[model samples]
Target: MLKFFRSIRQRLFKQKKFKNYILYAIGEILLVMIGILLALQVNNWNEHRKSKGTLKSTLKTISSDLKRDTIRAGYLIEIIELNQENSKAVIDRKVTIENFTTYPRTRSLVTIYQPFDIQTKGYDILKRISEQQENEKDSLFADLTQFYSLFIPNIQKSNERLEKVVIGNLEEFQEFPWFVDWSQGNTTEEMIAYFAISEDYRKKVAAYNVLAYGNHLQLIKGYKENAKHVLERIEKRLEED
Candidate 1:
C-alpha cells in the first residue's frame, strides 16, 4: 500500500498536478487516520470484553465465598443457640452434675466461644479491581463497598466481644469458691452446684451469653442476609452480557 501511494504521488508530481496531488495526499492521510481509529476501537472492544469476563469470574468467586460465609454464619448462630440454652439452664438452676448430660447444650461454658472467621480473599481481589476502575464508579462496586464496610467491623467487634466475655469468665474461675481444685478438665460437683445456684456465677453466665454472644448471633444472621443479597446482585450482573 505504501508503494502504491508513493507511485501515485510520483506520477502526480511528474504531471505537475500539484493541487490534485495535495488532495490525494490529504485523502491518504485521512484513510490512515481512519484505519488507526478503527484499529484502536477494535482493540478497546477486546479489552473491555476481557475486563468484563474477569469481573464476572471475580464476582462468581466472591459469591462462592459469601455462600460459605452464610453457611458458617448459620452454624455459628446454631452454636450460639446451644451455648445460650446451656447458660439459661444454669441460670435457671435446671442443670446439675447428675443431669449435666441431659442438657446437651452444656457443651461450652467458659472455653469455646464462637469467633467468626469470614472469608475476605475474594472481596480483596474485588477491591483491587474497584481501585483500578475508580473513574467508572460502578454501582455494583459501590454496593459491595457498602456491604463490606458495614459488616466487617461488626463481625470483628462481635468476635472480640465474645472473646472478651468468655475469656473474662474463664479468668474468674480462679476466684470462684467452686473452682479451687480445678485440676482435671472434668466438671466437679462443687462447680456444678456453684454454677447452678450461685447468683454471682449466674450473672457471669448471663453476661457471657446475653451481652456479647447474643449480639454476635444477630450480627451473623444480618451478615448472612446481606451476603445473600450481594450474591443475588452478582448473579444478575453475570447474566447480563
Candidate 2:
C-alpha cells in the first residue's frame, strides 16, 4: 500500500503540476491522521472492556463476602440470644445449685462466644474498593458501610462484656461449697447446703448481673439490623436488571 501511494506521488510530481501535488500531499496527511485516530480508538475500546471486566469481578467477590458475613452474623445473634436467656434465668432467681447443669450450659455458651468477634474483612474489602477508586459513590459500597458501621462496634462491646463474665468474676462464683462440692457426686449434699442461700448467693447474682447479658442482647439486635441493611443493598444492586 505504501509503495503504491509512493508511485502515484512520484508520477504526479514528474507531471510538474505543483498545485495538484500540494493537494495530493494534503490528502495523504489527512488519511494518515484518520488512520492514527482509528487505531487509538480501538486501543481505548479494548482497555475499557478490560476495566469493566475487572470491576465486575471485584463486585462479585464483594457480594459473596457480604453473604458469608451475613450467615456468620446470624450465628452470633443466636448465641447471644442464648446467653441472654441464661442471664435472665439468673436474674429472675430461676437458676439454682440444684439444677447445677446451668453451669455447664453457661460454659458451652462461653465456648460459642469464643469463636465470635467483630470482624471487618467484608467491610475491609469494600474499603479497598473505595480506596482504589473502583466503586466510589456506588450504592453498594455506601450501603455496606452503613450496615457494618451500625453493628460492629456493638459486637465489640458485647464481646468485651462476655470476656469479663467468663474470666473476671466466674471463678469466685464457682468457689462456693454448694458448687464446688458437686464433683464428688454429692448432689444431695449440694442441695442441702443451698437450703439457706445467704448473702453469698446474692453476691454471685450481682456478678452475673453485669456480665455480658444485656450487652449480648444489644449485639444481637445490632447484628439483625446490619444483616437487614446488607440484604437490602444486595437486592437493590443485583436488581439492576
Candidate 3:
C-alpha cells in the first residue's frame, strides 16, 4: 500500500501538478492515521477481552471461597447452638444429679471450645488484582473490600471476644476435682456434686455460651448475605460480558 501511494506521488510530482500532489499526500496521511487508529482500537479490544477473562476467573474463585465460608459458618453455628443448649440445661437445672450421671455427652459439651474460622485467601487474590489494575475502581471492588477487610475482621474480633469469655469461665473451675475427673471420662457422683456446688461458675459459662451463640448466629447471617450479594454482582458482570 505504501509503494502504491509513493508511486502515485512520484507520478504527480513529475507532472508538476503541485496542487494534486499535495492533495494526494494529504489523503495518504489520512489513510495512515486511520490504519494506526484501527490497529490501536483492535489492541484495546484484545486487552479488554483478556481483562474480562481474568476477572471472571477471579470472581469464580471468590465465589468458591464464599461458599466454603458459608458452609463453615453453618457448621460453627451448629456447634455453638449445641454448646448453648448444654449450658442452658445446666443453668436452668434441667439436668439434675440423676440425669447428669447418665448423660456424659452433656457434661462434655460444656468443656468444648470451638472457634470460628474465616476464609480470606481468595479475597487476598482479588485485592491484589484490584490494586494492580488501578482503573478497575467500581462498586464491586468497594463491596468486596468491605466484605473481606471490614466485615470479616469484625466477625473474627467478635469470635475472639467470645473465646476469651468462655475460656475465662472455664479457667475459674479448671482446678476443681470434678472438672478434672469429668474430663477423664469419670462422671461420678462426686463430680455431679462438685458441678452442683459450682452453681455460680455454671451460670457464667451458660451466659457466655448464650452470648457466643447469638454472636455466631449474627455473624453467619451477615456472611451469607454478603456472599449472596457478591455472587450476584459477579454473575451479573459475567452475563454482561
TM-score each candidate. Answer: 0.87, 0.66, 0.78
What tens-digit string does per-residue lDDT give for candidate 2 at 2-72?
Answer: 99989889988999888888999999999999999999999999987876665555556656665666677
Candidate 1 lDDT, tens digit per residue, 51-73? 88878888888888898999888
- C-alpha lDDT values of all predictions: 0.78, 0.60, 0.73
Candidate 1 accuracy as TM-score = 0.87
Best by TM-score: 1
Candidate 1 segments whose C-alpha is farther than 4 A from its true place? 96-101, 104-107, 134-138, 174-184
- Give model 1's clash tally: 0
User: Local error of candidate 1 at 80, Å?
Assistant: 0.9
lDDT string, candidate 3, 1-241, tens digits: 7688789999999999999999988988898899999999999999989877887787778878888887887787777776676667767767777667554446554456566677777778778878778634577877887778767777878778767775775686587767777656676676676555457646665667666766666777778777887888878876887
Best-first order by TM-score: 1, 3, 2
Candidate 3 regions off by >4 Å?
1-4, 7-11, 102-105, 108-111, 132-144, 166-174, 177-183, 188-190, 225-241
- Provide C-alpha RMSD values for all models, in order: 2.6, 4.8, 3.4
lDDT of 3 at 8: 92
